[model samples]
Target: MAERKAALNRAPARPELKERLERAKTIVLTEEQMQEQRASFAYGNAPRNSRITKASATSATKRIRLSDPQPVT
Candidate 1:
């Protein structure tokens, strides 16, 4: 219990580490800002003209070897 208490009360060693921690805590976005960020991410995944084809998707998956040496009996 004493060890845990000491660990909890200790401050970050570096000034930059303390500053980063404070910055992270104070980063509060408004609803409009959050919506804009979400929209940017959604569009970033694919351009306006990009399309996914069945062949492209299926090619990404693993395939079983039809000519296996030890075939299932």
Candidate 2:
């Protein structure tokens, strides 16, 4: 439609994003830092004492079961 074409021709939502990305600095993490980052994401923001290990994470999910489906009217 003509409206769709006009919308596509408009400027991007973030016109300065390209320049901002070009000016941004890149970080290089050491091996140990990378491992820590991975662990943080895997375990989320859980407390240290309650955080589950990777093995436990899989096992915990395995215990979950979906409820029986209800028939539609």
Query: Which candidate tops TM-score?
Result: 1
| Model 2 weakest lDDT span, ten residues long | 64-73
Estimate the Cα RMSD of every predicted model relative to the unseen true structure.
Answer: 19.6, 15.8
State in Å the error of residue 16, model 2: 14
Candidate 1: 10-residue stretch with minimal lDDT: 64-73
The Cα local distance difference test for each model comes to: 0.52, 0.57
Model 1 pairs whose backbones collide: none
Residue-wise C-alpha lDDT for candidate 1, range 20-63, written one tens digit per residue? 88776766655454445544555555455767433443333223
lDDT measured at residue 21 in model 1 versus the true structure, 0 to 100: 81
* Candidate 2 local lDDT, 1-73, one digit each (tens): 8768877776867858976665543444454544555555657755688858865654554454435423323
Can you give the TM-score per candidate against the true fold? 0.36, 0.31
